[model samples]
Target: MPSLRIACFHLNQLGDLVFSLPALLALGRGFPKAQIISVARPPHRELLLLSGLVHNVVERPRGQLISKLKMVSALRSMKLDLAVLFSTSLGTAILAWMAHPREKAGFGKRGLAYRAEKIGPPSVANNLRLVEALGCRVEKRDYVGLVKLDESVRCRVRDLLMHAGIGESTPYAVISPAASGRRAIKEWTSEGFAAVAERLADDLDLVPVLVGTEADEVVAGLSEKIVDLRGKTSIIELAALLEGAHVFVGIDSGVMHLAAAVGTPVAALFGPTDPAITGPMGEGHKIVQSDVPCLACMKTSCREPLCMQRITPDAVIESVAMCVSEEKNV
Candidate 1:
């Protein structure tokens, strides 16, 4: 087989990007001589770089039309042998089509979903299908790739936590209380998170550290029991903190996926999204979700949102206990 040049565009949401790791790793191994160009959004660009799965990571900043066009020009210059799209956006398909690769494959066709009986499968399996189209079958399909942590960053985060009074002997749990702004309905109540954090502190003797971006500050502040590290650490720094966490408790968001990527125990709280589709993609993770009638609706503008409301703090705490207990057993 001749050497191939592969261009894969996977600048999706954080959870979706995490789901693509196994396929990307397999592709790199399947064609060792292939010059794989990975395209992803910020933070994820750092992740792909840390994973060392691609020859180069094409940084695609948000709201940058020129950047996208320039990437297309660069990809066209490569004369790509295969173009794999992990997302189903029309723009992504056009980008793949515009690149004029010898073969193009993706999850579900955006325009063709209506005519087809079924749309995309689970996010993880869907991404693997793109690699499968190129005649490669992955032996281990659940890998999110190995994430390399900078020792300097890890030491720095430890110093920061120590300054915050978290000693080296203290067992800490990471609590990510927010998701995307548009998907607020997917989040559990602030009171529920607070209750869980308090219980974790009081009963388990574990410090709950709230970690997220500025968007997560409100909920992180709601719980006085947690050590709010919101908007402080960079993405890689946050990964280092999660790497040391004994347990990670959060919604169906990217941080949960990140914790799973770093081999941490995750207590994934699900509401609007299906756990089977986007739960923590690793072992020894506990999922806490309600069986509400309107659960898994994937609605952005839900008025009632009982699905999120019904997931009680007790359930979350139990899930946390289960996750940490499994961690202890391991």
Candidate 2:
């Protein structure tokens, strides 16, 4: 019999794609003989490739209509047995329909064979609902042990740490103070982060290493005492770095999700967004949210985001310390 051919339409944001890992893992376990393919962004494609879940990845289309048409033609030629849309949009639904897959799976009644509706918080469970629509039993819904980092990547991160004055044996905490896109209002203050850095060094004996994209450096900055690694590492390399860290402290961002995926303990600070909807997954993670009445506002921008500003550095230090202690116990 021919191997079952599956195509996963996975064009998603970084955290959203990470949220989809458990469903992908379930797919792999359910049909071990199948050839599963994923269509995702270039960076996300690398992530799925490292997870060892999908057999191959095709770059998600970008730019003009011609590019999308080319992608549609390529997918149609494969005669996919199943096409699952992790990103449930009308446009994506149209693309899946154009591909002419034998069967289709997605959220809502988008002319698909299988459909899943929005569920409760902790969005990982919601992602699994779509796969369950395909008759796959999801025993695990966490990305903790799904993605494996190569030894080479670990060595590279080790070298990077050494250069940054962190030895391989040094206990360190990764701090990401910036949130991507319009979520800037969700960020805790730089002053608060700097104070947390000092506390990590002086009180907990953990070095605070700042990590983010170049665009985030200005927003995530601490003093010269902190080792800033913004724009220095690729996504996979960042994963390796987070994997080796003692703990990760950050706002609600894709970096926090990445840290959780690598099994690092996370001290996530939340304000404008709801933690239950998009917080870090799995165990050994701490969510520190403000007590503001307007919490979980889900607003992209706020002139005075007192919710984030209200979370003091002392609270964060306490959470970080707890995460470290819990990790040590583990």
Candidate 3:
């Protein structure tokens, strides 16, 4: 076959982009000389830029027909050999078809009309891990890890730690107590996270770093002793920070996936969702969930979130302890 210039489309949120990194890396490895482009959103663009996997990041604009037409025109200009649509949306499939790549690939489900050399249903473990399912020859390798951080980002993180009055050498854990949507029933309460942080500090002598966006500052504010970095770090900076942490504990959010991508040990909380579908991937990660009947509802909103409420701080602390101990043994 000729050298393939591929375009991979994953126009979802941050976590989606993180999980898709391994597959993108595999593609890059398989076709080292080919130009690879990604269609992503704002923060995701920053992520892919930092990831160093794609040759180009095409910003997906927000508008109606005119904007999409412009994007299609751009795709046509690339003269791509292959287009991989990661979503099940008909619109995305249609876009791949209209782009007129020699080969279009995506899930073969729900009557999505597209000509593809490879197609399969979604995998529950990791979306990127699905590359093996595509019938492509994949080495039995540990799923490709996230891209390495540059020294500049690492130095910035060290400065951030110093500004926070945290020593660069001090081992710490990050606690993210906020979740974005109703699918985020996997999030523990602020009080619950505070309790766990307090215990971990007292017992393990590790500082607790609180992380989130500005809207999540209230959650970080609940912890008196935690080093709060909410609303401060960018997506790339957050990944660098996670790289230096000893362990990370968070709800089912983008940060948790970031920690996993950076190879940090993670204790992720799962509620009202299946860990199989969206939990943290790779080794050195543990997931804790409640046995509530209404769990895995996958609903955007819920009136009663007992599944989340029932996951006590003590339980989370225990999971963290286990991950830390395992890491030390290794």
Candidate 4:
């Protein structure tokens, strides 16, 4: 549309950035000459850099109103032609309005001042599926695939694999045991992940690469056999590592979404969250959840987490085995 400059606002968590990759791809294809700019958290800047579709990344600081005002001023300088707010936050819509883009699009029940197109009811599933609902005339809608890595990051991942004693020819599965939130109800136990990893290692001969941020180190400590790569790799490097892995097994976390974005087959464990809404969007994703009445409550704390406790290690092991076998056959 005459070399339009587009700005996409997704200042949420790391997984949110990953999930929005498909929409970014669609924008790139739909407007080939458009200069795509992404405004997101600092931690996700690397991800935006790795995504070849983005022309620039505007980092939004989580701080006072003065800081946000400064960011808004910076966005104003960009002179964006179109803005897409992928997040459901009012702040994002406000930022888009502050940018003064020609056209703004977002999803919310209430109307936003600058948002020209508003998709009804902001749900997790609808948010992820917005590439289609937004009604952008594109050939494909299911573009939520893995993000590409820069050459430098690819080289770093290769070196990391070599340093870990994992040969290029060796097969491996990635296990991410930690979720982002502090809610114990949402997370499966560390012992369950350990058991799955051990079984996968023993039966399938697939080495398990444990991945997460620094906060997940304690969970990583639970597994002695796994190659503890927590807090060791950057966002781009993690994408490269996930791209090479045969499969990914993890709880409902950002890494799980990252794995799905990377186009890796995933077997995810779900507890207090609804898989139908937040599960990985892909063909090869297999979600395991228990039938507990209190499940999908999205509660932060609970004395009893039957939803997660019922998801035994044996079930995960079996799922892993099935995924491994299917991959081999492919």
Candidate with best TM-score: 2
lDDT (C-alpha, whole model) for all candidates: 0.79, 0.85, 0.76, 0.76
The TM-score, computed over Cα atoms with residue i paired to residue i, of candidate 2 is 0.92
Poorest 10 consecutive residues by lDDT, candidate 3: 115-124
Please say which candidate is ahead in TM-score: 2 or 3: 2
Give the per-residue lDDT of model 3 (tens digit) for 46-86: 67977787888887766578888888899998898887777
Model 4 over residues 1-330: C-alpha lDDT tens digits? Answer: 357888888847776676677677777776778889989888788778766869999888897899889988988887888887888687787777888987776675454323333333233334445544545444544435547666788789889998998888889999887766654567777778888878778888988898876766665677666888887798778888988898899888777877777788889898877777678877677888887888787767788889999998878877777776787787
| Collision count of model 2 | 0
The Cα RMSD in angstroms, rounded to one decimal, for candidate 3 relative to the true structure is 3.4
Model 1 segments beyond 4 Å from truth? 108-122
Segments in model 4 whose C-alpha atoms lie over 4 Å from true places: 64-67, 109-135, 143-146, 182-184, 297-301
Q: Cα-based RMSD of the predictions, in order?
A: 3.1, 2.0, 3.4, 3.1
Query: What TM-score, to 2 decimals, does candidate 1 have?
Result: 0.90
Global local distance difference test of model 3: 0.76
**Clash pairs (backbone) in predicted model 3:** none
Better of 1 and 2 by lDDT: 2
**Model 4 reaches what TM-score against the true structure?**
0.86
Backbone clashes in candidate 3 total: 0
Please give the range of 10 consecutive residues that has the lowest summed lDDT in model 4.
Answer: 113-122
TM-score of each: 0.90, 0.92, 0.85, 0.86
